[model samples]
Target: MAHTTERPVREREDASIGELLSAVTSDAQKLFRQEIELAKAEVREEATKAGKAAGMYGGAGFAGYMTALFASLAIVFALANVMDWGWAALIVTAVWAVAALVLYMMGRSRMREVSPKPERTVQTLKEDAEWARHPTR
Candidate 1:
C-alpha cells in the first residue's frame, strides 16, 4: 500500500506589500527609539556611579588637606621632646605628605572602578540587532 504525504504550508500575507512595508518601517522606528532610550538610561546609571566616586575622591582630598594642617602642628610639638625640634618637625611633615599621597592613590583606584561605557546597553543592543536580522529564528 502507498501512503500520501501531507506538508504544512506557510501563511499568506493579508495586507498589501506597501502596507506591510509601512508597518515594518513603523515598528523599526519604534524599536530604534526604544534602543536609544535604553542606552540613555544605562549611560545615566553609569555616570551617576562615576559622579559618586568623584565625590568620594573630593571628600578624601578635603580630609587629607585638613589632616595635613593639624598634623603639622602636632608633629612640631611631639618632636620638641626629641633631639632637635626642627628635625622632628621636618620628619613629621614628610610623614604627613606620604600619608596624603597614599590617600590620593586610594581615591584614584576607587574611581577607576567606575567605567563610563554603557556595557549592558551595548550588549542588549547587539542582541536586538542580531534578532532583527534573523527574526525567524
Candidate 2:
C-alpha cells in the first residue's frame, strides 16, 4: 500500500482571514472593472445612436424650415392682394420656429439621459478601488 501525502493543514495554515478577504475583494474589484468596461461600450453605442438621431433631426429640421419658408412665401404672395390676412405669413413662420425649438429641446434632454450607466459604472469602480486600498478586513 502506497501512502499519498495530502497536506490540507499546510494550505489552511498559510491563508489568513485578511488574505482571504483581500482575495475576495480583489476578485470583486476585477468584476467591477469588467462591468465598467461593459458600461463604457454601451455608452459608446448609445452615443453613436444619439449622433445619428441628431443628424436625422437636423436633416428633418432643414427640410421643415425650407418647406415653411416656401409656404410662408406662398402665403405672403396670396395675401398680398388681401389686407385682412397679411400677418398670416408671420404667424406661420413663428409657429414653425416654436415647433423646431420644442423638438430640439426634447431631443437634447433625451440624449442627456442616455449615458448615465457609464457614470454609475465609473463611480462603482472608484469605490471598489478605494475599498481595495483600505480594506476593512
Per-residue lDDT tens digits for candidate 2, residues 16-127, read 7776666666677779678868787878887886886677578658866886878778877787666556586776678677777776776677677566456766776788
The sequence of per-residue lDDT tens digits that candidate 1 reaches over residues 13-106 is 4556766666678777988898789879988887887787777778778877887789777868877886588898788778877877877787
- Top candidate by lDDT: 1
For all candidates in order, the CA lDDT equals: 0.76, 0.71
Which residue pairs in model 1 clash with each other? none
Q: Which stretches of candidate 2 lie over 4 Å from their true place?
A: 1-36, 45-49, 56-60, 84-88, 114-117
Candidate 1 runs further than 4 Å off: 1-12
